[model samples]
Target: MTDYGHDLLFGTFTTPSAQGAQHVLDLAVTADRAGLDLVTFQDHPYQPAFLDTWTLLAYVAARTERIRVSGNVLSLPLRPPAVLARAAASLDVLSGGRFELGLGAGAFWDGVAAMGGRRLTPGQGVEALREAITIIRDVWDTEAVGGVRQDGRYYQVVGARRGPRPAHDIDIWVGSYRPRMLALTGAMADGWLPTIEYLPRGVASLPGLNARIDEAAEAAGRSPRDVRRLMNFMNVSFSPDDDGLLAGPPARWVEQLADLALTHGVTAFFIGGDDAGAIERYAAEVAPAVREIVSRERGHYGSMP
Candidate 1:
């Protein structure tokens, strides 16, 4: 058995294009074959630029095993809680419980407007996110609480029941950029997955984000260790020369990630498949190294593999 958190795991985030779905599924099989831990798809609707992430992931899930699947970050605000919960629960059950839910306060204003909905202000969206999560969780656990209730603001759930719970409780990861978002993530999410734009680069920026997360978790009376820290990183290929990928060389990457696990309480890292050639390259050059890395981390983190 391998510890899910200890392993320096890597995966892909394919663009939500119909033409890409088949490729995405193919890549998923590739990840499983290559022994990678997870894969994710981004969610959006009627963009005319991407495929429906949930549908695509469902497609991929049907054809593979071992590899965990997730939404890079589902736009929770655009969806009604009961419907969304059912969708995720269905996926969870159908996929043999290998599902992760990545939730984000929808921010694509134009897309929202196009859907005949107004864009939510930052504050408004966050509040909406809060309500949305609560509603979904409630529906999954009980039959008479799946409807809507309001607290003088945002969409509220009344008195509806949500039954037929998912086979397993799915892990939830929240996306964040601002302090408030990060704070919320620390308090409520099972994990944190940040875009590359916000992940720390210099020595200074990194510590602050880590500190805030710890502070928030502590204040909330949750152990910082319970929440995972993950970086949404792009897999940049080197000519066997460049500084390697951000997670570092295969073995070093595992070591570095373990250090981060100890420091920031991170257990997962989402690797995006950017270059068209990354799949082949990782399969050939990076995959074997990672297998060994996981074996090492297994000695320390306990096994979920």
Candidate 2:
């Protein structure tokens, strides 16, 4: 078992479709009212059918009360790090410290190029993201003596004035899967956010992937637990019988999630769907159950002689 000893968090992941704008807001409110810890929306700036993720996030933050809001993973290629940092800080302050950043290295190069973002190879994308993280953090470091200055291959910031620190220390969660991205996540990011469905070998891929992050963290002189593990469940269902993964009943979900926490050290769970009922059930039933089970297991292990 590989418990990270972090508190378990449950949340919803809703699509930011322009056609379903009101519905998306309703889902965020539902998750908030249902007591979910966080609510996230997919970010695809190139998608004409989707609302701007950052704008939608601001609106949703105003509409919701307690639930935290974030992009499932904001596309970094289209968002300049300095401006993105200030915007994030502004939203974090506006939301009363209820904002977290889930960011990604750019995907869909053709669409990015069409949208006026420079196309980058996968390796370059990783390096660019690393540089972006540095710039973003520098922009957030208002306590620093001088303005932010970084001359990097991908981003160049010359003495950029930093102000408007966030209301809270907003965690930067990176949506990463590959080796370089995973390593970067461990070395620099606060959390790892990866969709389970996208894993090459499904859940079985986690151990090796997490090992990569763990090794990277260790090599970087950081503890592996420094990076919290978060998973997005895109293919979830509340069925009567057993299907697979998170497709079973709420009890099954609770069990599976508790096991994930105890065995794999996944501390956060985001259910990706627009179903209000599922959100409610996940909040009302599965979340508490998973937390209780994991807490009990941790206590039991701690008491072992």
Please give each candidate's TM-score: 0.83, 0.98
Evaluate model 2: give its TM-score.
Answer: 0.98
lDDT of 2 by residue, 100-208 (tens): 9999998999999999999999999999999999999888889999999999999999999997899999899999989999999999999999999999998888889
- After aligning candidate 2 to the native by TM-score, how far in Å is the CA of 268 from where it should be? 0.6
TM-score of candidate 1 against the unseen true structure = 0.83
- The residue-by-residue lDDT of candidate 1 on 41-116, one tens digit each, is 7778747678877778888888888888888888776666668888888888888888888888887788877887
Candidate 2 overall Cα lDDT vs. reference?
Answer: 0.92
The number of the candidate with the highest lDDT is 2
After superposition, which runs of candidate 1 have C-alpha atoms over 4 Å from their true positions?
Answer: 1-8, 143-152, 200-204, 244-264, 274-277, 280-305
The Cα error of candidate 1 at residue 66, in Å, is: 2.3
